[model samples]
Target: MVHVILTHEVKDFFAWKKVYEEGEPLRTKSGIKMTGVYTSVDNPNQVTLTGECASAELVYRFMSQPELKAAMQAAGVISAPDMKVLNKV
Candidate 1:
């Protein structure tokens, strides 16, 4: 499995979490598995998460979807997310 680390800022962490939780089924259908979420110690609006997926390629494809963009926007993502995929060493 490949893991992706994603970081971004949200207008409101709690509101964003509500949307993220609601979107779990969509992610599962796309073959993405998520871990517990996280935030900066000093900045609750700054969010981060690690997700496991079949491949880095799948992660990019899922991220590029228009619906995903819409969902992110609705979820209060205020910045373009930075994501990196890693394979266990």
Candidate 2:
């Protein structure tokens, strides 16, 4: 299994959380099993989503979709997301 970590800052964490929750269908379709959602210790606006997918390709494809960009915009994400795909060493 591959792990995907996507972190970013949002304009409003609560608003982003609402949109993120509504994206369950998208994540399911992309074969992404989200394991956790987190916020920075000092900043509630900083968000991180952690999950597992079949491969890095799946993650890239999911991230590249226009729907995702739209969702991010709607969620008020203010910064470019930092996404990393990693396998256990």
Candidate 3:
């Protein structure tokens, strides 16, 4: 499986979470198979999201989508996210 990791800071975790949850259908349709979200213990505003995707290409496409960027902005993501794509060893 392909894995996608994303880390970013948000203005409000709960608000961002609500928007993230609302994007489930879009994510699924874009080829995400499963997803997990976590917040940093040191800083609650720092969030990490991991998703299992069918392929790295799909994940790349998902991340590059304008809609996703707009949604993240609306969700209060305050900084550009760091992203990584991995393949299970």
Best by lDDT: 2
Writing each residue's lDDT as its tens digit, candidate 1 over 1-89 gives 89989999999999999999998988998899998699999999999999899988889889988888999999999999999899988
In model 1, the runs with Cα more than 4 Å from the true position are none
lDDT of 1 at 80: 91
Query: All candidates' lDDT scores?
Result: 0.93, 0.94, 0.90
lDDT of 2 by residue, 23-53 (tens): 9999899998999999999999999999999
TM-score of 2: 0.97
TM for every model, in the order presented, reads: 0.96, 0.97, 0.94
Give the per-residue lDDT digits (tens) of candidate 3, residues 1-89: 78888899999999999998999888889988657899999999999998798888898898889999899999999989999899899
Better of 2 and 3 by lDDT: 2
Instruction: Tell me how far candidate 2 lies from the true structure as C-alpha RMSD in angstroms.
Output: 0.7
The Cα error of candidate 3 at residue 40, in Å, is 0.4
Query: Of the pair 1 and 3, which is ahead by lDDT?
Result: 1
Better of 1 and 2 by lDDT: 2
Q: How does model 3 score by TM-score? A: 0.94
Looking at model 2, which ten-residue stretch has the lowest summed lDDT?
56-65
Structure candidate 2, residue pairs in collision: none
